[model samples]
Target: MANQAAPVRSFLQAAAKTEEAPLPLRVVQIEGLAILKIIKHCKECSPDPVTGQLLGLDVGSVLEVTNCFPFPTRDEDEELEAEGANYQLEMMRCLREVNVDNNTVGWYQSTFLWSYQTEDLIETFMNYQENIRRCVCIIYDPSKSNQGVLALKALKLSDSFMELYRNNNFTGEKLREKNFTWVDIFEEIPIKVSNSPLISCVMTQLETDSPVNQCDYDRLQLSSTPYLERNLEFLVGCMDALSKEQQELQFHYRILARQQAQQQAWLQKRRAENMARKAAGEEPLPEEDPSNPIFKQNPEPSRLNSFLITNQIANHCNQINGAVGQNFSRLYLTKALHEN
Candidate 1:
């Protein structure tokens, strides 16, 4: 165990030094087969969020994800939890015996309509970060893929926010001191899908054997109204949820302000009474501390949900714009042909 720990410690030290430099870790390489497997798993679990474990090695600043396996749906039973843990351990052991990249670098999950940003995801990333210094969460959007584009993103908790999270401090003052915001909590790393020469050659042969080409752009259909409508609906839903959360936060702040004002008034009254007692040639009543049970602190509400809703709304808007633009272009082309 010491022998293995030495290499990991050295690697972490090197990574820390690299982080200190101006250069940033921006690139993540995923095997072509791994991507395909992820997509397949997501499709199979369509509409429901699916999770998987990523096995890979970190080479300098690049994270190479070589393999993955899907996890079954989690139940609220303790027996199931134990079974799941044992299963994962046995699987990792088997991979090690087979000389595969058994190191758990991170995890992946499927998202619908960019709804991957949530408190659950944040907690999961925090747990992984605590165990591994440089852990990431990969989000795969099958909804986007249905529109002919594959969407895969790698996200990690930012260093500053991770420290705050580790200490379990989300106070307004602490957040302000660290300059933390929803956008800064998760940093998205760029991803590149790579295939070996042999794999490329095999793909070429398979393409040649296909009777019909799937890339016939000339015969492509231009109807995207369904996609546009879906995106617009999602956007509206997100906006509504965001507005409600904002109102709730505003209400909380108002209540807090009112409570503080009342507390101050009570303190002033107590001081006045104490002054009268002192002037009357008697011992002033013992001063009461505001920290007493009467002044209970209100726990600050989490803004994570609001931030996630805003992000989802933004993504929906972008998708809607792109779909609209494509429709407009198609219309203009059709009109020009008719005029000509």
Candidate 2:
């Protein structure tokens, strides 16, 4: 049985290698039920992070998230971890019995102001990549959601970045050759909330019964100072983290420069000694030796950490950028109303 499986596995791998990659994800179509579940879970666990599994079909350029379920939150207990695994299996089995879409498309997580571009996030996506050919991570920011708009976004790691990550090589030269940067780490795909006919009908009925004035009270409310302040605080923290990463990269460069200088000086010494050996009619030593510890090229330090930090900083900046203008508008409106 093992021998037969080996041939089949090799054939599948060969086919995979020859197959062309699908187009980049164009849009994420999530059912209203899935969206509401995500919103409820995130809002209930506000300020704390939570994640879930996204179940759906990946057809063509569209990923339809038909359903989702939250993950069980357990700490570093082996027994509890086993229970969590079992829980997932049971959930999938039950869903399958109900003729629901039980396939795993990816997972979703609630982020704090879009701060989901960290090392851990990348590691999680890579873990998914091991089992799934193509998957996405859905990010829903509760803090941003409270301000009248849904802050849900779908993200998938760039193929180029993932390839380099699988090789565990984020060196400066490799990144330059591939033209990968912090911005290239994750590609944000547009999300569209798909509503079923029943859901649409229900919404229409609710709209008719709802007050015509709707949410004018909340709209005019001036409670943005605290939100803006919090965003600024996080932005500052990201900047500090970015500075530390820069320090680490700078330190690496200093060590690299010192190593290069030593290598060049050693090469010059070797050439001079070889010339003396020639004059003395003795056999000249080779100019380079791979086995020599001194001549061995230093393996470059990976730049993955720095790249993640840079991406985090960018997220914080964009969050602050959008929030600032909105806050300023609210503040001016409040002041004018007070003067009246």
Candidate 3:
């Protein structure tokens, strides 16, 4: 993987030179069947995060995701890790033999309540980005999809964060210099579902043969108390986690400040002792700076987790608000009918 990164970087550089301007990646085109497969896979792995590889090509700035396959859910064992890699390799080999898009464009994973951002996820994205410059992570929220709407997102690690992450420098000064924020870490790429004419025709025929039932609309209008209750619970949990992380960060800052003050005081004492030796006409001791190589700088604590927790809380709030609005509308309708 390390060796492969150079060629990928070289290719991107050459590609950039040929273009009039650096073409910003804009669209993620996924086949309708591919989307169905992703949704099905997510449903099967409900309550657990499921991941798979994406196969496609990059044409200009548009990424066409033609196919995907789910990875088996296995525990973190060395044997399983080896098997997973082999499985992916063999799968890509078979796709190539069939003249399909065998290139590894990115990968997809199922997330619950927007809990997709984490250190593990960041590391995975970084690995993919190293191998494929335009690699993205497709997040599918099955919980949301079950609520009559599909929730899919295409996200790529932002270039600024990528550089910072590569250097393994999350120092406070560096973060402040970059003006880094939670939102800036991952850039969401717009996605559009696509289908061929033949596929579209087949769908139309199927729709005619098995028309959607009107009763489904009535069921959709019914309030889902369990869903609402679960969402609120999740929201509260996220808020608690967010608050705890904030406190931890504040405590870390105080500790860091105290350490700095102690170092300064020690340095001052050493300087005074050296001055006294000079006054006594004795050989001055070698000056020692407390801020030397021996005192390694503390790596800034990661705020990525806190930021992600905050984002999840926001999503939960939005969901709760939508549910409440629907309930109020139903209540108002019921009252009006009773009056009539």
- What RMSD, rounded to one decimal, does every model reach? 5.5, 4.7, 6.0
Residues 143-202, model 1: lDDT tens digits: 777665677899888888778768877666777787777677778899999899999999
Question: For model 3, where is the 10-residue window of minimal lDDT?
Answer: 210-219
Q: Give the Cα-based TM-score of candidate 1 against the true structure.
A: 0.83
Question: Which pairs clash in model 3?
Answer: none
The order by descending lDDT is 2, 3, 1
TM-score of each: 0.83, 0.87, 0.83
How far does residue 250 in candidate 1 sit from its true spot (Å)?
Answer: 2.4
Q: Between which residue pairs do clashes occur in model 1?
A: none
Which number leads on lDDT?
A: 2
Pick by lDDT: 1 or 3, better one: 3
Best by TM-score: 2
lDDT of each residue in 301-340, candidate 3, tens digit only: 7767776787677778888888778778777887888899
The residue-level lDDT of candidate 1 at 189 comes to 93
In model 2, which regions exceed 4 Å deviation? 1-23, 79-81, 208-217, 289-293, 336-340
Error of 1 at 9 (Å): 13
Query: Which lDDT values do the candidates have, in the order given?
Result: 0.80, 0.84, 0.82
